[model samples]
Target: MAKKKQTLFECQHCGEQSVKWLGKCPSCGGWDSFIELNQAEQESLKYLSKQTSSDKQKAMPITKIEEDDVVRFSSNNTEFDLVMGGGIVPGSLTLIGGSPGVGKSTLLLKIAGNLAKSGKKVLYVSGEESAGQIKLRATRLDANEENLYLLPEISLEAIQNEMLRENYEAVIIDSIQTMYSDKLTSAPGSVTQVREITFELMRKAKESRIAMFIIGHITKDGSIAGPRVLEHMVDTVLYFEGEQSKEIRMLRGFKNRFGSTSEIGIFEMTANGLESAKNISNRFFSSSKEQSGSCLTVTAEGSRALILEVQALVSHSTNPNPKRSATGFDTNRLNMLLALLEKKLDLPLNSYDVFINISGGIKIKESSCDLAVIASIISSFRNRPISRESVLIGEVSLTGEIKDVFSMETRLREAISCGIKKAIISTKPKGIVGIKCFEVDEVSKMLELF
Candidate 1:
C-alpha cells in the first residue's frame, strides 16, 4: 500500500497554516486568503523544517561561546551608510520597501555603482526589468561602472550558478516577490516562494560572506507585500518615505541587528539622481515673514534635531459636527488638544472646524510639538500672527500642564541655528546660550505669551 499524503493550507498574507481550508485566515484576519498547498510544495516545506531542526546544536555554556568579530564596509553613500548603522556588514541581508516611484530602485542602483567604483565586484539582478532598461537608468545615474554587472534573470538556480561562476562581493535583487525557487511549485511572490527564496539567499550570503540588498514592494497599508516571515529573516528593514511629487525623501530604518534604528537618512531627488541632503536644518520650516495660523517648533529625530512648522486653520462651521483633519500629524492627538483648549482656555473651539498641517512632507512623531500645535490653533482663531523668531518646544497634558520634552537643549540649539531667538518651554535649562528661554508650567500661563 502507498503511504498517505498529508494536506495543508496556508494564508498568503501571513503564512498561517491549517490542516483544512477555511474562508478566512484566523491568524491574519484576511478573508479568503487560504490556499491549499500542492504535494511538491508541501514536501518542500517539510524538508525545510527538518533541515532547520536538524542543524540545531547542543546547548553550551555562555562562557564557552566565542564572539564573532563584526566587519563593515562603506556603500559610498553618506545617507545610506548612516541608515545602515555606519556601514554595510558583510553577510548581511537587508530588505528595502517603499511605495511605487519613491526611489527604491534608483537609490540602490546608485549605491551599486558607488560600490563598483570602489573596486568591489557587484551583481545587479533584475527579475522585473530587462538588461537594456536597467542600462538606460545606469547611464542617467552615472552608475555604468566596469565592475557592476547586470543580469536579467528570475530562476533561482540560474542565479546561484552565476554567483558560483563569479567572485561578486555584493548582490542586489530588484525585488524578492519576483524571484521564485524551482523547489516550490507555488507562484512567484506567493508566501511560500518568498519565504523559500529569502531563506536560500540568507544562507548563501552567510556562507559566502556576501552583502545582499533585496527590494520589496509594499502593500496598500505600507507594509512589505509578503509573509511576515520575510521581514524576520532579514538583518535590517528599511522603508523609503516621501511623495513622488516632492524632492525630499527620507529613508528610515525599522530594524537593525548591528546598530540603533533611530537614525534617519535624508536624500534629495535631482535631475541626476538621489543625492544626500547635507543642509537640511531649514528644510522642514520656512524662514519667511510671520503669518497667522503658523508656528515653529523643534523636534528630535534620533540624534539630529529638526525645526518644523506647525500650521493650523480655524473657521466657524455651519454644520452641527465641526470637521477635524490633520496631515503629517496624528489626528487623535489634534482632537485631544482641541478638547483641552476648549476646557482649559475657555476657547469656543467646539464650534469651529480645525485643520492642522506640518510643513514639508515630514511627519511629526514626537509630542514635543504639542505646544506648537496649540499655539498655531489659537493664533488662527484669534487671527494673530506669531513671531517667526520664537520657537515652542513642550508637550501639553490633559490637566492643562505644560511638560518638558526630551533633548530640550538639542532642540533649542537647532532652533537657534535656524535664526530663532526665543524659546518657550516647561523649564529653562542651565548654561544654555544663543537662544533665550521662557518657562511656563501651565497651559493657561502659556496663553499669556501670545
Candidate 2:
C-alpha cells in the first residue's frame, strides 16, 4: 500500500497553515478562506520550514560584526528619491502598491528611463501588457534609450533566465500578481505562488546585486493584495495615494530600511508624466477671499511643513440624531471635538449637522490640526469668516484646554512663508519674526479670537 500523503490547508488571507480544512481562519478571522495545498505546495512548505529552523549561523556580539558599506544611486527623480530615503540601493527589493490608474506604472517607467539616461542597464518586464503597449507609453514618457530593454514575459523561470543572461543593473516588474512560477502548481496571484515567487526573486536579487522594483495590486480595503508576508519579504514598501481625478499624488513610505519611513514625496500628474510638485508649500491652501467655514493650519509631513485648509459646515437638522460627516479627517475624532464644544462652550451642536473637509485631498494625520478644525466649525456656526492671513496651530484636549504640538517652529515658518501674518497657538514661541503669535490656553479663550 502507498503511504498516505499529509494534508495541509493554508489561509488565503493571512497565510496561516493547518493540517485540515477550516470553515473560518482563526488567524485573520476570514470566512471560508482556507484552501488545501497541492502535493507540490505541501512539499514546498515543509522544505521552507526545515530550512528556516535548521539555521547554522550563531549569534555574535554587536561590536564584533563588520558593518556593511551600503551603495546607493539616484533614480534622477527628486520626488522618487525622497520617498526612497535618498536613492535606490543595489540588491534592494522594493514593492509599490496603489489603486488602479494611480500612476504606478507611469512613475516606474519614467524612473527606468532616468536610470537608462544615466548609462545604467535597465530591464522592464510586464506580464499584463505586451511589449508594443509599453512601447507606446514609453514614447509618451520619452523612455526610449539604448540601455532600456523591455521584456513582455510572465514566467518567473523565464525572467530569472533572462536576468542570468544579461548584466542588467535594474529591473522593473510591472506587477507581482501577474507573475507565475513553474515550480508551484498554484495559479498566479494566489498566496502560495506569490509567496514562492517573492522568495525566489528576493534571493536572486541579493545574489546578482540587482535593484528590483515590483508593483503590487491593492485590494478593495486599500491594502496590497497578497499574503501579509509579502510585505515583510521586501526591503522597502511604498504606497501611492490620490484620486485619479486629482492632479496631485502623494507617495508615502511605510517601510524603509535605508531611510526614514515618515518622508513623503509629492508628485503632479501632467502630460509629460509624474513630476515633483514645484510649489508644494502653496499647493494645499488658498489665500483667496476669506470665507466662513474655512481656516488655515500648518501640518508637518516628515521634514517638510505644509499649510493646509480646514473647512467645516454646520446646519440645523430636523432629525433627532444629526448627521456627522468628515472627509480626509477622522470621523471619531470629529465626534469628540463636537462633544467638547458642546460641554465647554455650551453650544447647542447636538441638534445640528457638522461636516469637516481637508482641502486639496490631503489627509490630516496629526493632532496639531485640531485647533483649525474647531476654528472652522465655530466660524461656520456663527456665520463669521476668519482671515486668511491667520493660521490656527494647536491640539485640543478633552479637558477643554489647548496643548502645544511638535515641530511648532517648523510649522510657523511654513505659515509665514505662505504670507500668514498671525498665528493662534497653544503657547507662543519666542523669535518667530515673520508671524505674530497669540496664546490661547482654553477652548473658551479661543472663541474670543473670532
| Cα lDDT tens digits for candidate 1, 292-380 | 99999998988888888999999999889999999999999999999999888899998999999998878888899999999999999
lDDT of 2 by residue, 353-414 (tens): 99999988988888899999999999999989999999999999999899999889999988
Minimum summed lDDT over a 10-residue window in model 2 is located at 45-54
Q: After superposition, how far is residue 297 of candidate 2 from its true place, in Å?
A: 0.5
lDDT of 2 at 168: 92
Q: In angstroms, give how far residue 113 of model 2 lies from its true place.
A: 0.7
